[model samples]
Target: MSGRPPGAKSVDQLLEEARSRITRVTPEDAVSRMADGAVLVDIRPQSQREADGEVPGALVVERNHLEWRFDPESDARLPQATGYDVDVVVLCQEGYTSSLAADALRSLGLTRAGDVVGGHRAWVAAGLPTTGGPAT
Candidate 1:
């Protein structure tokens, strides 16, 4: 028997559910949204940023603190956490984690939360601007 409870969902199921709740964007689409004032939030850890570089102007809010930083009602929120209506696009090394993170933002009432289709890798592959680390 699998160790999980009878009704417990698998990680894949959870991911799918999370993804269904928010729209995912392509790297190019992400750029367009950014140009239109959407915030591109990079949720990768420092170690990964050091190894893979980072999007030139993406906000660096690691996954752990994401909820607090983006929750407009939280005292710990960033100044930009103006309200639930702000457009927030989260990114990770790959697309997987960002989907989940974006869903979490949606739960916090950030109606415009979403993620990049292929994450930072796709961004780099698409020739979007990045900084630090070795060139891909």
Candidate 2:
């Protein structure tokens, strides 16, 4: 231990704590909601998306720009980020980053923001729809 503090948190600890604060979905459930108009926001970088394919029709909102792209009041927000109540499901390569992304979105008043439990890898494993093309 570095002994910085008595209550210091590791990265894994932080990740688990973040996940515990939100509702995470399975790949199947995410697809079901996507079909029902819930926005599936992919936060993986473009290179990762190209390397392993991506959920077809999912919005590609790179992690770095997530706050600007999802915050409704921001001029940079995507049009689909309509309001605080919009159902948004964030996805990363392996589900880790997504939890943090969803938690951030929730902090921005997007109450329904959540992450796919196992991320895009799980989605592919579940045989969900995916496309191998340039990031949109």
Candidate 3:
């Protein structure tokens, strides 16, 4: 045995489970949805954003504060987090963390939560609009 608990799941397993709970969007699709008022939440850290650039107008909530900032019922929630029906599309450096973050949002009753497939790298690859250097 690898010494994990009886019911333990690997990171890959957790990621797979998270992805299954929501519909991931491509960079193009995410932009379209953004135009239609979807909230594009960027959860990358400052260092990553500094290196990879940022999505113009995307909410810059770092990963650590995501749950508090987006949780509708939380007192610390953002003004836009009015309810559970909000369309939240989370983005990370490479898509892995975003999937987990979106899953966490869903657990908080943000039923419309999802992530950008392939994350910032894909966005840069697709030539999507950004305000800084290309995603690394």
Candidate 4:
């Protein structure tokens, strides 16, 4: 018998609640968008990326510097030479981190920002072509 409210959620449940705020898109959809000129931004750490071959044509932007680089307000930023309205998709190894990264990008006014739901692992699993380094 517990004294907590009937609907009270545990700590794990609360954290998961926050995680669900991020939107996710399927790997196939991401690929289609990429073919249509959407920039696929890989935010996996360099070591992981090097260990596992990267997606062909995906922009390699380390997670730590992603927000500053993508956020238009940040003076220490890379020029959005392709224009700010470009569709940008972020990816990580397992999809979790990329969701947060995409949400952050959306917060920074990148309305077209999104993340790969199944991530690079799913991309590889889906038989997509990759380049850079040897396959994991």
lDDT of each: 0.94, 0.89, 0.94, 0.79
Residue pairs whose backbone atoms clash in candidate 2: none
- Root-mean-square deviation per candidate: 1.1, 3.0, 1.8, 4.4
For TM-score, the strongest prediction is: 1
**Candidate 2: where are CA atoms >4 Å away?**
5-7, 133-136
Clashes of each: 0, 0, 0, 0
Whose TM-score is higher: candidate 3's or candidate 4's?
3
Which pairs clash (backbone N, Cα, C closer than 3 Å) in model 1?
A: none
> What lDDT score is found at residue 124 in candidate 2?
82
True-vs-predicted CA distance for residue 121, candidate 3, Å: 0.3
Candidate 1 residue-wise lDDT at 117: 92
Candidates, ranked, lDDT: 1, 3, 2, 4
List, residue by residue over 1-136, the lDDT tens digit for candidate 2. 5566877888898888888777899998898888888999999998999898978889998999998998999999999989888899999989999999999998899988999988998988787878994443
Q: Write the per-residue lDDT of candidate 4 for residues 1-136, one digit (tens) a residue.
A: 7587988887667535435654567888888998998888999998888888888888888999898887776776776524457688889998877877787777677878888977898988888888776735
For residues 57-136, could you state the per-residue lDDT of candidate 3 as single tens digits?
89999999999999988999999898999999999999999999999999999999999999999998998888876433
- Compute the lDDT for candidate 1: 0.94
Tell me the deviation in Å of residue 116 in model 1: 0.5
Q: Is 1 or 2 the stronger prediction by lDDT? A: 1
Poorly placed runs, candidate 4 (over 4 Å): 1-23, 81-84, 132-136
